[model samples]
Every structure is written in C-alpha cells, then in structure tokens.
Target: MFASVFVVILGLLYCRKGSSQSFLGRPRLYGPSEALAKEVVYFKCEVPDYAGDEEIYLQLFKVGDRNRSLGGYTSLRGEVGAIPKVIKPSHEGYLECVVSAQNNSGITPTVSHPHYLKVIDPVKGAEIIHSDPMEFYEGNALQLQCQLSAGTHVSYKWLLNGQPVSQSPVHYAADNLLRIDRTSSKDSGSYMCMATNTFNKTTVFSSNSSEVVVTIKDFVSSPNIAFTVLKEDSQNYSAVVTCESTRGTPPITFSLYNRTELVTNMTTDDRQATFKVPLVLDRHLGWLQCQANNGERIAYSDWLPLEVVPAGGPVTMHYDFDLGENYAIVGLRFYCKVKKGSHLRYQWFLNKTLLQDRGSFYYVANEAPKQSILLLSVGRSSTGTYHCEVSDSFDNTTAISSKKHYLDKDVLNRLPILLVAVVFGCFTALILLVSICCCIGVMFRRRQYGEKSLLNLEMDTMRAAYEGDLDLSVYNEDPDVVNAARGDEFDHASEASVDE
Candidate 1:
C-alpha cells in the first residue's frame, strides 16, 4: 500500500507540470493593414505568458505564394520590424506576417491577416481634347476635356495662364472637363489641365496647354478688288484680279466673271483670293467683275473693262514721185502711200542706195501710212533715180515701184537761155542797168526754181488721189527723155515738109 500511494503522487505531479507548460495562449501577429514599398513596417508577437527572454521570430509571405517568403525567416524579439527596400511592382501582392514565440516549455506561432501594399509609378503623357472652331466669338459656349495615358484614378484641375483658374457662375469644372457658359474676351488666354492621383502623390502631371482667342466682328461689307495688267499685246493679254473682305469671317469664295460668263473660281480662308487670266484674245474683251461670298453675305466689286485689239490684215502699198514739168531745179519730193496694212516698214533708195533720215540733204519730212514724204534739196549730187521699197512686216512680203521715172539736169540747162534773154532785152537800159538787169534775171531764174520745187511738193500732196492702175516709177532713169528725143525727129520732118 505504501508503494502504490508514492507512485500516484509522482504521476499527479508530472501531469500538473505538463499542464502548466501548455498554459501559454496562441501567438498573435499585429501589423498595419497596408504598407508601401521601401517603408518600415513593424510587427509584434503576443503570448499570454510571454517572458522577456523568450525566443521570437518573424517572417513575411506573399499571399498565394507557398514556395517562398517575401523576406526569409528572421530571428527577432517579441517586437520585430523590417524594411523592404528592393520591393518591385510584383511585390504588390497580399502580404502576411507570421510570428513564433518559443520558451523552455513549448512554442506558439500565429499568422496575421493578408495585407496589401501598393507600389505606384508616376503618370505619363497627359493630353487635352477639343473640337474645331478654335476661334470663338463673345457669349459663346465652350468645353474642354483633359485625359491621361496612364493612371486609372485621377483628379483634374483647370489652370489659366499657369495659375489656378478662378471658378465663377459662368465658368466651372466637371471631373476632367472644363465648361464655360458664356465666354468673354477675358477668357482669351492659355489653358492647362493638371492631373493628380494617388500613384503620383507628390508630383502633378500636366497636359500641353491650349489657346483660346475671342473677338467681336462687324457685319460683312462689300469687297474691294484690284486689277493688275500683267502682260498685254495685240494678240494676247493677261491680268490678275485680287479680292479682299476686311470686315467679315473667313472662308471667303471669290468668282471672276467676264461679261456674264464665269472665268474662274477660288476659295480662301484668309478672306482674300486672286484670279489670273493668263492668255486672253480679242474675243475676250469686255467688262470683268469679281464677287466674294462669306457664307452670310455676298459682295461685288466694281466693273473692270478689258479691251484687246485684233492684229494682222491685208497689205497694200501705193507711191509716186514729183518732178516739176518746167524744171525741178530747187528740190524734189517723193511720196509713198500704204493702205490696208499694219506693222509696215518703208525703205527709200536713191540710185539703189539706202537713204537714211539722219542726213540733212535727204530726210523724211513726214511719215504716215497715208503718205510719206522724202524731200531732197536740189544739187548736182542730188540728181539720182529714186524709188520706194515697202515691206509688210506682218506677212514678210515686199513690193517695189513699177514704172521708172527719170530726171536729167542737162534737159533743163538746154532750154532755159532763150526765155531769160528775151525777158532781159525787153527791159533794155544803160550798160550798168543791163548788168543790174542780168543780175535780176539770175534772181528770177532762182525764184523760178523755187516755184518749181513747190510744184513738186504740191504733186506729192496730190499723189494720194492717183489711180492705182497708173504705173509710175520713182526710180533711177527718166522715160520721158526718150519720148522727147523721138518728138524732135517728128518736128524736123514736119519742118522739111513745110519747106518743100
């Protein structure tokens, strides 16, 4: 009996000791619900019977990853802390903190609820979006939208001229869009959109700024057009017409018209346009005008008249020479007539030598299509066969006088002595008087030559009335000399017959 009681007492004592060792509560881990990368996080393990000298350890595990811990198991005290500096976006998964407390009696381990850590990156490529009609008038409504290429959750603020925009009843912001009820000239300035979010807590991302310009315009008015003659000639003509509206909205259309037919059309956003007519003919001659339209109003310019003359026509030439009947001693003149031709060239020749108007002895007195006069001061050197040669520069045709006329100084010298002697004898006087009378006779002869020279000038004036069928040559030799010689033979025969 004594031995059985001693064994019972020992078994009871062993049971009590084992129950005291197992009396510690389960270990509990305490930490923040969320953490950021590279931030220090502290975790604590609690035991109902924890001792200051107990061995405690901490470990972090990523949720859904059973193969490894975020940070390898770390030996620590009851309270432990860690800094995950090299954490990446892949480390943004759920995180769990496990803590174990151990003493000489037993070990107690506990795990914390899954915690989420956010790894953020900055927002990039911010932008703005809007519609056309970039230019607006006062009292118009406007809307603008701002967006970002990155970041899901973002807050937007409007800025004007790099300053926070003041909110008014007419101007306000809606999420990422800015709206204006009635814009005014004060609203004309640069606008920017700034975006901020949790991902970029310390930094703000901004979109490229946009500009708004407002104006007040007047009613459309008549457009002014200026006409410029670029090139013009008998065959072809060219001109440019420019039109502008100074007081109207842009996108103006201009139309150029010749008479009633449209020649060309152009449209421009700058409220001005130019029309060019490069090559126009005689048929295109008429009144021209331009019209401008600005969608709301139409205006017309003053009429501009264009005239073109036709070129090229038939060519004809008529000419004659004047040698007085008595004696062309003073001077001689030649006349040429051209009709039904344009761009005609006249050439005069004396004995087949080209006569130039530069010299004083032979010069062109008057040059015209109806009549051209070549006056030659009479002298021994002036005696030459003269003829006119004409050319039609338009058709490149040439014509010469048909009949050749002759002038001989010898003929006048042979017949002039008898008349002079008879006139001088009728005025008989003393020897000295006779000498004076001879001098007077010489003066009279010179006056006669002067009168004969005027006769040739008169003939030149009358040449225009000469019939075209009459062949008259104003050339090198006189045909009348042969006729006069033949007449002398006839005169001799007639005198002999009378004597017989």
Candidate 2:
C-alpha cells in the first residue's frame, strides 16, 4: 500500500502543468515590465474567460519578502473590461504578479511575469516658442504663423511690447493683419511670442528689426550700395566708384548704368546703400549716379568719381565700417563688402575661407547668400580678414579685402587710419632698402680699396635683420661663433626661423 501511494504521488507531480503558464486574463498589476514607478502610470490586464457579467479579482504582493497579500483590493474588477488603471508605484523593486480565475473553480493563484520599475524626476513644463521667418519685410502685411510646438498645454500670448496686441485696426483680433497698412520705417521693431504649459513657461523674441525700414511709397529699405557690369567683355579690367546720399524720404529709387544702359535699379526705405561698377575701359567708365525719390522729395547721390585700376596689379579686396550711426547696436557687424571679378563666381571669405553666413544679419534680409552685405555686431571674435574672390576656368584671384589690422594704436576708430599706417610702414621699409643698396655700393668701394672693413659674419647677419630677413641659418663651423649657437637650441632656432 505504501509503494503504490508513493508511485501515485510521483506520477501526480510529473503531471504538473508547464513551468511557463499563460494567464489569458484575471487582472494583472500595472507593471510596465519595467516602467517609471510612482508616476501616474496606466496599466491594463486581460483574462481569457472572465466574460461579460463575470468579475475577476486582483491582488498585490511584494515578491521575495515575507508579507501578506493585499487581496481583492478592488484596483479594477470588471469581467468584460480590460484592466487599465493609473496607479502610483509604492516602492522601487520587483512587483510580483499573482492572478486567479474568479466565478469559477477557485483555482490556485498563478504567478505572472516579473517586472522592475524605476522612478525618476519629473519633466519641466513647456511654453517655449521658436519660429522661422521671424523678421519679415515691413509693408507687405505680416503673416506670423504662431504655434507652440511643445509645453503642457501652455497658454499662448503675443505682444508687440508691454501692451496686449489682441486686435488689429483692420481686424477684430490682434492675431490678424500680420499686416501693417501703409507700412512705414518707424513701424519696425522686435516681435515676441509667448507660450505657457502646466510644467514650465519661457519666452523668446526676435532681435530688434528697427533696421527694417519701410517706405509708404515704396517697400522695405533695400541695399543702397549696388553695382553694374559695364563693358563686360573688357580685358579683365574695370572701373569702380562708391555711392552715397544725404537726404530723401525712403522708398528712394536708384538705377545703375553701363554708359547709357541700366543694369540694376534699386529702391530704399532708409539712409544709405552701395552700388558696384563692373571693370571696364575708358568709354564704359562714365559717371555713376544714384537717384532717390519718394514722391515727396527728389534727392540725388553725388556722382561717384571713377578710378580705373591698372591690369597688372593683383585684384585687391577692401572693407569699410559705418560706426557713426547711433542706432547701431552690436559692436561687431558687417557694414559692407565690395567684390570685383572678371572670371570667377563671386564668393565672400572670412578668415581666408568661404562661409555661408548664418547669423543675426541673415535674419534681417532676404538677399541671396551669393551676394554679400554689411554686417554690424562686432565682437573680439569678429576681428579677422574678410575678402572677395572671383575666378575663371583658367585662374582665380582675390579681388577685394578689408582687414581689421589696418589702423594705428590710437586711431583704431576706422580702417582708413590703419590703411595709412600700412602705407607708412611700407614707405619706411622702402627707404631702408635704398639705404642697403647704398651700403652695398660702399662695400664694393671698400673692397676696391683693398681693405675688409665691416662686412664680417655678424655684420652680415645684422644687415639681414634690418632688411627683415629673420632667418637664423647659422654655420657654427665658423671658428669665431659656436657656444652662442650650438646643440638642441641652435637646431630648433635654425629650423623654425623665417628668412623674411
């Protein structure tokens, strides 16, 4: 009888269900399998036969610890419903899932899959707004498509200043007319949009667009300085004249002429603009005129005097800064860049390299990236070499440049001062050259006199220094000089030194 009973017990144990049991439904706990515990997390569970009218039960247990089960706690007990409830997790650990079928055979509870939950800090709210095409050309009517792409249902608010611009003169709501009727230059300024969500709120505004000068008779102020290509076929030669104007009601119109023909005519809503004249011979080098009118007043720019550069000189680059303007804000800004070319497509270079500028200045205008403009907003980092280069299939040349180092120590207010310094520096250098030539003539005279005076090795080196040849190419083999020029230091000196 004992043997039979033992064998029967073994057979019963062998008949136990598979180790992994699939619980179709019976309300599983909200375990993300691994989720942010304690966060208002949504959980759902499904049972196989707990159909409509039949209710299943749920219980909670902390796995591995000696603890009583929280039975039938009533988290969610609907037969037909998928158990989905948002519950905050109590602790950071593995949550054991114990489930059982209700309204049935009262089967023993089966353990469900184990899941680990983690709790973390909450996220900040969103009321941050960033929009492209922030500063539009004035006078065309504003179309600001405002939207808060993020935040916790942040409330939206738009303001032109401290005043609530909730309505427009032409519309019932301030949101419409992104339009300004008879737009004028005085209307330009910063536009700020605000959005606030539940968690956090912040604001961003476009840089002041006061520079967005608009004319009632014309449009937004265009680049006053412009250029033309006269006698485009001339042998890589051209004449240039800088344009300037003193008075006018903006929306002023000016045309560029190639002798008797016009190449480009531009209008402005503000004070100044530049025009470029193509490289040409004598006939094409006529007066370069800029005319400004806004229906109320007729103003003309002084006829720019022309200079024809010699063909043999390399294409030169130049730059200028308009610091006298009181309205200017940033210290480092590009005011103007003039480019001259015969063959190469024009491209601007910063620090001797090409760059498609993406800066505050770009936000101010819609001109082509290929065309350069004046920049303001100067900083320490803004100091560098800027130039324009044009090239052809055969050769490329840098035609214009404006360097930051052109001024004297005290007269650093403008580049023209620095340019004068460079000229004086060069002139000084030329005089030194002449003196050296005279010395060489004297040396020949001394040699003819049959006495070696002062052309010794040291003297030769000193002469080289005065000539700006800073090379340390020394021959220690000279019996007269060694200790002062030997070993590792001498080797380094010779290798790193420049001859000029």
Candidate 3:
C-alpha cells in the first residue's frame, strides 16, 4: 500500500510541472531598402497587436543576407508598444531594421510586418540679373552674375545654345559665372547651368535652361526686313527695339543716338533692355545698334535697319467715300506725329509735294512719343506715295520714310463718278484756253475796225462752254465798247451757268 501511494504522488508531481511548448516561428524578411530621393521620408516595424502577461520580452535587429544576424535589441515590452519605430535613412539606398518578440507562455517569438525607407533629390534653381547704360558704346565693359544651389559635391556646367562654354576659364571653372569681356549678338542664346552630385550611390541633378540675349552698343535702328505698316496716315512716329543683355548687373541705362547727336534714352528691367523713340524721324533709316555695359564689360548689337514711314496720306476729315470705294480702305489717316519735343520739326509729303500742315490741325505732338499713334482722315486722292520726314535740326541731316499704296484701279473703277468729274474738269480747261486765244486775236481785230459777225457770236458761245459767260458776251458784243462792261456784267450769270 505504501509503494502504491508513493507512485501516485510522483505521477501527480510530474504532471504539475509545465513542459508543453513550441519552437520559435520562422524569421520574417524585412523589405529591401529603397528611396525616391525626392519624396520618401521614414519607416519602421515591431510586434503586431501584442498583449501578453508574465513580463514579455522583445528585441530589435538587422539580419544580413547571409542569414547571420547583424542587429537587435532586448527587454522589449510585448504590450502594443515599439511598433513602427520610425526609422530614417541618411542617404538613398536599400536598408532595413528587424524587431523580434518573445514570451514565456510558449518560449516562442512573433514578428510585425516589414517596412522600407526612402529619400528624394529636389530640383535646383538659378537667377541672373543685370543692367546697361542709357547709351552704351564700343570699348565698354560689362559684368554679369548668376546664382544657384544644389546637392553636396555637386559640379556645375555653363552652356550657350546647348554647347558648353570654353571661354572665361575662371567662370568655366565650375558652371556659375558667365563673363562677357565684350559682348555681341553671338553671345546671345538659350543659356543654362546644370549641377550633378552623388547621393548614396545615386545621381541627383538640377538645372535651368532659359535663354539670355546679348546686345551691342548701337545707334538708330532700322525697319526690320520682316516689317509691315499698319493703316497709319502721314504721321511721324517712333520705333522701339528691345535691346536685351539679360546677363548684366543693374542701374544700367539705354540711349538713342542719331549719328553723333543723342536723341532719347531709357532704363532697363531684369529681363529686357529697350531703346525707344518717337520713330517720327527717319533716324532709324540707318543701322540701329544697341549697346550695354555692366560698368565692367561692354556689348553691342549688329545694326538693325528700321524706317519711320507714315501710315498713309491725308484726306478730308469726312471725305467722300462715294458709297462703293472699298479699295480705299487700307489707309485711314495721315499724321505728322512729333516723337520728341526736340525733334518737333515734323514734316510730311505726298508724291514729293509738301503737305500743307497749317498750325491749327495738321499735326499732333504727344508725351509718350516713342510709341505714339497718329491719325489723319484719308481719301482716294490722298492714297499715294507718302513720306514722313523728321529732323532734329541740330544734326544738319534729315530722316525720311517714303511709302506708296496703290489702290486697285479695278476698285477705283467702281467709283467712275470721281473719275468722270476729273476728266470733265480737264476737258473744260482745254476749251477755255482755246477760247482765250481766239478772243485775244478778235479783240485786236475789232480795235482796228468796228464790225459784227454772226459767226463770231456762235463761236463765242461755243468757246464759252468752257469760259465764263462774261467773256462769251464780250467776244460777241456789238463788236465794241460795251464789250468790257458786258464782260463784267455777264460774269455772275456765266459763273452760275458753268457750275451746272
């Protein structure tokens, strides 16, 4: 009986001890390290929804590809803590961290989902600022500057028209400064800078490909070959050319010069430099050169040819359109616009004939003369070659623009009324001339011998068809004295008759 009790007690004690446990779960694989280099930020992981008693323990780790453990931690709590640890990567590349969980309930482990870290490279930016003198000339100097920022160990490159710049070894040392000892149009192009650097075995770069234009110190500008005139009447005005040298530094002014005499001037903006004038002067007939300087380096443009031509001819304010005159529509006005108070000797012409610009209404001077607009009512008679001539009077020179507009005769033919009146006027003038000569001969004859002839009266009236009635009666009058008085008396009646 004693042996049996001892055996039962031992069995109870053996059962009392805990020994039903499972091996640790398979290891979880963390994600491969990856970064966008521009947008990605941080990542991490740990045991999921953990809730346990008996002092749960956990570890953080990094496992090598060779299956050897590289990193981990101890004393980790198992109560919904240490999850998504928020890991940050220094550079762009693949990297990872591992978190492990443990508990006494089974002496096993649990793993949360794996995560990835990413980094991004941002785009670079640059700005160029500059200015030029109001009137730049040759032998001038200009200095230009550009600024930018990018990634570490970054190298820079400067380009003109997509080609790398070899000039100015100092500026080319590392794509930043663009020095123009003496600039010209050839230096003008789409300019840009590029930066390249390595970030965690990945390349990050930034660039700006906007254009920069270089201009020269020049005089009057010429009308472009691609120029077209609007329907402006005979008016003097100005033409403007944007002389841009976007690579210079500020407070620069631009000026206009006619030969050796200076005409107008202006300041510059960050992007564009401009030269404006009243264009009313023919000064632009010559090469217009734009010059710029940055107080150090000077630049100039090839002469640009420009002309200050009138828009059209002058006509009555309300000329007779006569209903069907469509061809006369191209030109609407004539103007004698004064671009500058100094160049105000505004003069215009039609077919070499001086336009009668009386003091009251023929011309207009404006404050903003460079871009001034002129208007003069136009008519068919005024629709011919017209000229806009301007002189500073000081240059001992003149600028002129002559242009012609030929209305389609076919269009004018539609208005046969005006043509008919012109032709009839000419015919009447011819007849009057013939009548005058004949009457003179007759008067000489009548003074010698008093006489009357029926044929003479008929001839007088026939010729009078063109001459006035007074002259008609004189030639036929009682062949004598009353002739002179009759010439005066019939004058009014004949004038009325001829008008019809």
Best candidate, lDDT: 1
Candidates arranged by lDDT, highest first: 1, 3, 2
The lDDT per prediction is 0.62, 0.45, 0.47
Better of 2 and 3 by lDDT: 3
**Taking the tens digit of each residue's C-alpha lDDT, what string does model 1 give over 1-500?**
99999999999988966664554444444555443344555544344444455565556777777577666344434444452435554666577766554443344455666666665433556677778465655567878888766543457878776777778899889778898888765676677877765632554444443544334333345777765544444554466778777765666788888879999988887777888776453444678787887665578888876643222343333333346656445566667655433334567777887888746577875464444577766667666676766554332234534234444556534556888788677666466787998999999999999999999998986785684555566554667987898999999999999999
Q: By TM-score, how accurate is candidate 2?
A: 0.23
Q: Please identify which of the two predictions, 2 or 3, would achieve the higher TM-score against the true structure.
A: 3
Model 2 per-residue lDDT tens digits across residues 1-500: 99999999987755543221233343445545433323455443334444334334555555775275533333234432323333333444665555555653344555555556543222223222333243333344544434432222224444554444445473232321244443444444454454433311223222111112222233322224334333444266433333445543455666665445665666666555555545543343555555555555445544543433222223443435445455432443233222432223345556665645555432222133224453534554445555544333122442434443322222345347678899999999999999999999998997866644444666887887876855455532665345555666777877788543
lDDT of 1: 0.62
Q: Model 3 Cα displacement at 397 (Å)?
A: 19
Model 1 TM-score on a 0 to 1 scale = 0.30
lDDT of 3 at 316: 16
Cα lDDT tens digits, model 3, 280-372, are 443446656655544555455556556643322332111122233544443333434433333324455656766653422234333222322
Kindly report which residue stretches of model 3 are placed more than 4 angstroms away from their true locations once superposed. Answer: 1-60, 65-293, 299-500
Q: Return the TM-score for each candidate structure.
A: 0.30, 0.23, 0.24
